[model samples]
Target chain A: MVTEKIIKVHAPATVANMVCGFDILGFAVKEPYDEMWIRLTEQPGITIINKDDYQLPAEPEKNVAGAALLAMLEELTQPVGFELTIRKHIKPGSGVGSSAASSAGAVVAANTLLNGVFSKEDLVRFAMNGEKLASGVKHADNIAPCIYGGVTLIRSIHPLDIVALTAPPLFVTIVHPQIEVRTADARSILKKQVYLKDAIKQWGNIAGLVSGLLQSDYALIGRSLEDVLIEPVRSILIPGFNTVKQKSREAGALGGGISGSGPSIFMLSKDEATAIAVEKVMQDEYQQLGLDHHTYVTTIHSSGVEIIKA
Target chain B: MVTEKIIKVHAPATVANMVCGFDILGFAVKEPYDEMWIRLTEQPGITIINKDDYQLPAEPEKNVAGAALLAMLEELTQPVGFELTIRKHIKPGSGVGSSAASSAGAVVAANTLLNGVFSKEDLVRFAMNGEKLASGVKHADNIAPCIYGGVTLIRSIHPLDIVALTAPPLFVTIVHPQIEVRTADARSILKKQVYLKDAIKQWGNIAGLVSGLLQSDYALIGRSLEDVLIEPVRSILIPGFNTVKQKSREAGALGGGISGSGPSIFMLSKDEATAIAVEKVMQDEYQQLGLDHHTYVTTIHSSGVEIIKA
Candidate 1:
């Protein structure tokens, strides 16, 4: 009955905690994705192969993709097995959702192998297991967008209420310097309490940002992309963040902030030209410091995981 | 050159702070508006008269409407004068934007007399003077919606950025329990700092609410009307608040909270029948306490200020 069993998927990179929308908003980008292949087997366990230079764990139990697939398999009524081959272009700890790309892609492919047995929400829940293993916490900001595509808002995590938000055409520019800012350290550095006055301003900016995105008001979007609470604290961890942000704005980006914690920064632009121009600004900053970095100029990826070969 | 020398305007009441969107969001309701008649005076001074039982100040500086008009006149390139006659239906200290009605109503009528010179945002700025006179701060949560005629988000007050958001059809049920909760007291009772975890939840709810309204997702809206920050402390100020909210939801209301500071509560419903049912639920709770209350079941007022007689 199994005519063809191998499935390959392209899971795009996502930028989580978009500026003012910390721990809630994210969107997928077209490039810098992971290439994942899943083979449905008669055996009832997960196997992972790392085809990239990052040298991720090949052991199924320790791997991000393996853990996520195992979680999905645990919920299935039918016994199924998956062998994942992940070719990751996104480097782990680069803060561009490298683990998310692999985990979300693995689940999407395995779900296809099972004839789409799970809802997208369920996939997100499964993927959180992978995220927890990677970051020591269960957060869906990156997973939701990587699974559902485009922009996503994780309203509540307890009941898992996620909303796919509409957005205008936007180009994303990413600059990931060769550095590591652990998610735990970044989170620990944040104050447990925030001033109520500052919180009000943050909510105002976030509400305005959401309104601007839904209405396609570009100027308003640009104006509302400011982050008062997280940026002030997290910017310290990322080297040359202030200068890069200032120079990028001078290069015509709408606005952006630390992508998923730190070390990697994302900027939103209106056009490909501006995106590329901002990319140049990002590259030059690290180049002057003699630090190696990678940059990508891409647009919003509407379809989340693409079925490359089925 | 102005043809319409005299104008009789109706300014609707607004529900501010809209649950989680403290100091940011609000919406205008259809009924319980104030009636004001403004005439272009030959003399360069503002005048006022009260035709209601609530004996508010009448002097230009002391009056809410007069202070708002005075603020507008100071910014005018040309000297203008206005004479006003007031008939207020919304009672002061009822927490439903009584001062905002008078302030926005006066400026709107005067703008007509001066051939519509001030922009809507400027009108909000001027009307904020009245709010400052009433409450100890210049907040636009009520003024923006009362002038812009829908759900309005005050993005920033420094430069006066306000956004008018689109929402689906919703019926508003208001029950004004005859008690005064001074805006200062309600604000002062709140902690100057909030837990980052609670703030995140509040922002998530507010972001969800905005997305829900934009997408017309009624279920999401209902689920997101929760306020973890302001409501917990302020709900105590309103008698029978917990029972009324609990019973209204049971009676098919979506959800809602304190109108502005409290003492008056508002609930949103899907249809007129549900709205009326929620209204009865609201009335019964206050009546059981032997508290005199006024209730109104009305839809969203699309146009904030209406010229009843021109």
Candidate 2:
């Protein structure tokens, strides 16, 4: 079953907590991704190399990538040792699914080295183990999109029901400010209990967003891209968030909000030109705040994880 | 603006609190509507005639139908008197939008006699005044669908934004048990606070249902019709509710739950034959409980409020 001597895979950065669908929806972006190179070894466990500038642990069990590979290997009948080389393009704590990209990339690379032993859904499960190690919550919001690509809905976590929604061809603009907002800090800011009235509005907007995506109604998507609950709390942690969102909409973004937790924001547009224009707005808003930020204008990643070289 | 001499309008019954969309979504049914006949009068207020078995108030300010007409009249620059005759077909407290039908029907009849003076949105606002009198809550769940037809979403109440969703051609089977479950009782039974986890699952299902309706995916509709919150509490009040739902699913219903509050349960099927099959299941379960129930096999009323004769 081990057909490949060496395998390299790429997993794209994902956007989680999508507007009205907090903790239940996500989608992949094309520009920023984490690349992993893996090769079989006689050693019993995973070994990491070329983790430049990153302070990730070299020990297999302690590393985010190693935890995912270990989880995947534990399920295999014919297990093999792997030596991984990670080239991290997505920065950690950027709120752009940096951890998910690494976790998903590692499992995908290991699965490829084993000649694709695991299904996409199984890979998502295994990748969630890495998420648990990284963020202490085994959430699939980022992992599902990183594994399946496109917009994905986590219908129920108890049964692990996930549906990959049909999305129109659209461009994405992301701006990651050079600041750290821990996932735990962002989550702790949220109210433990929400009003039933606000929850009803949230679900309605979620329904509208799903319809807009499937129907390719840009205006509907724009109108539906509103969050009444989570954003009001978590957005306060991100500096210039209000200005960035307003300016992006003013510059003709379909709509957008805080990407995942905070420190980064994303906007969706119908065309590349609008996406670029929206990126400028994001950049200018952050610049006015005297913050260093990185902007990426790209389309949605439809092809999730893929073997780049084997 | 008072151009017409007489007008007769029909407002169809509606299903509210649609599964995961509690208090925010509803759809109109074709059969079992309330008809209103209205004519301009020299008197400055609404007057009622032809009272049947129903004990509805005759006073324009206190009556559900009259309250809606009064609200509409308050917005008019040149208010006119109207004499209304309501032919009630939808029984009160049936959980099939009886009050909404009366309220929406009255405003529609009055608007027709005035040569279509108010928009549908304005009519919904006027009709909500009637809802406040009927259920002590100005909810649009039932009223929106009765006014707009098809599946409708109440996005936000503060701004009064409602979206009319596209739905597939499907048959509905409604069985109203001859027992009343007051709307106040239904509201009191629900927990003021729900787990954040369950709320996330609910919103996900709502999104899935909207996608299913718009895409005409029957299986998706069935899969998404589940409720993890409200039905658990309200279904306890309805006799043989569990058996009816299980048997209907066995009989090939797309899926279903309580129609609005309780006593009336509705099932949706992709075909008329399946709808008829599902209805028998409902009848058998209710018969076993020794309860008299009324069943209606109908389709979604696409054209909401229609002027029968003008």
Candidate 3:
């Protein structure tokens, strides 16, 4: 039932809520993504081929990719058939938006195979449904930047106002240690209420980040990227977050903090050399703990989802 | 006591927070300021000439303009004599940073007469001291705009991160009702702790406001300009705040909100005519209440503090 068309899809890894931009901003990584081969078939039912070692849900409706596709197809009455094979690169729940990448990637590939019936915005909306089923909250910070390249600012959740920012060239380094930290646990540890003083500082930092991104002022961006609200609560989950950040700063990174609900930490630098340096420091720390990990030195990626072998 | 040299100073009115931006952002008003005339004299001490009808403190440390001058003089060792005259324009406590204007204007004018020793940044730092004395808390959202024109993002209070933003061409309307709301009372009424859900929404709106200003998308700017954290708590002090906002939206305003600590409401529009229309509607509401008021229809001001006659 396989057709003559075989398409390779690349969905870039993304760091959600970059530092002070918790739940409101995100940007795409330039390298190391979960690759998938998607092909249309003459048969009526959707199929999933096993590729990665990680266990996936057998039911298509429960799988992130499958759930997203099902949601997209629900809008269309015509029976659509396709087989998807996913190669997981970024580990799930590493605070690097692994599920969002899969869900967003599948929808992008499926939409392209369907001749682009739904818009990119619609794709993001559909992907959020997948996230909702996964995490129980339809937060757009992770899904938006993965879908639309560069830095994305999610201004509102009710009507979902998301603006794609033209990012300056930033060296992004993400360190994912071989550890487990559930997002639900991270969310639970946060205090039910925060001081207004801290809230003001956070908003100020948000304004600074937005202005910094727009003007392409790297130093300003670095200075504005401090988190007084979320990072204080979340960093406790990561053993050496403060030490990693300090080392990264000493190694010429502008600044960095916990990536998403993290077991991963990310840093921003002015150049690739500095980014690599930060990565080395992270690796050194992980090695001290005698743990395996992965590090990526990437830039502000302007390209997002791509249709390969069309 | 008046000497030969006459120094004329102008301080632009500022809109603090610009809708969704609360306590962490502000921008300058182009025209109309509290102008002051200062003259070096042979007289041994600082003296205040006839100015506004109100009996402003003649003691340099007790008065806003006098405090600014004293702060400026602290840097200069040589004892100086001066006569200061004020032409008050910006109404105090209207939330358009009226005190900030007077303080910034005084320092700028004094610096002009003193051969320009203090830099703009230094002036802002000194003015923050003056603001601390005035409000019992040191914050730069108001003073930064008055000292450095255009939109200013105060990212932190400890290290004092401030970046001035060059705003796009947009019409502005500000209405100040002849009612006083003390900053201390406004500060005291708010609860110390806020719900996490509200904080999330506030941060989201702030991120939206920042992104909106950078992109220069008017509708996006309007949509993102929502303040859930501070506005709700603060608006209770101002009468007819909700109605004015509703009417302005009906009159085709992009958006509007409380200027700063309250009693003044500011709105932004795409054109001058609409700006005028919005102001008229706000004024009509004030008129209906049989209350005295003042309004300004202006644009984004690029000029900060300047000496007209040096």
Please, what are the lDDT tens digits per residue for candidate 1 over residues B23-68?
9999999998999999987788898989988889899899999999
lDDT of 2 by residue, A1-310 (tens): 8664788888899999788899989999887988888898996778888566877778878888888888988887775788999888888899989889888988888887777768888888988988899888999999999989999988766677778888999899999999889998888778878877678778878987887888788888898899999999888888998988898888899899999897889999999999999988888888888999999999888878778998
lDDT of 1 by residue, A174-284 (tens): 999888899989999999999999999999998988998999998999999999999999999888899899999999999998999978999999999999999999999
Candidate scoring better on TM-score of 2 and 3: 3
- Docking band of candidate 2: medium
Error of 3 at A50 (Å): 2.7
- In model 1, the Cα lDDT at residue A190 comes to 96
True contacts kept of 3: 0.86
lDDT digits (tens) for residues B166-245 of candidate 3: 65688899888889988878788888888777877788877777777777777887887788777888898888789899
Query: TM-score for every candidate vs. truth?
Result: 0.98, 0.92, 0.96
Misplaced by over 4 Å in model 3 are A1-3, B1-3, B42-45
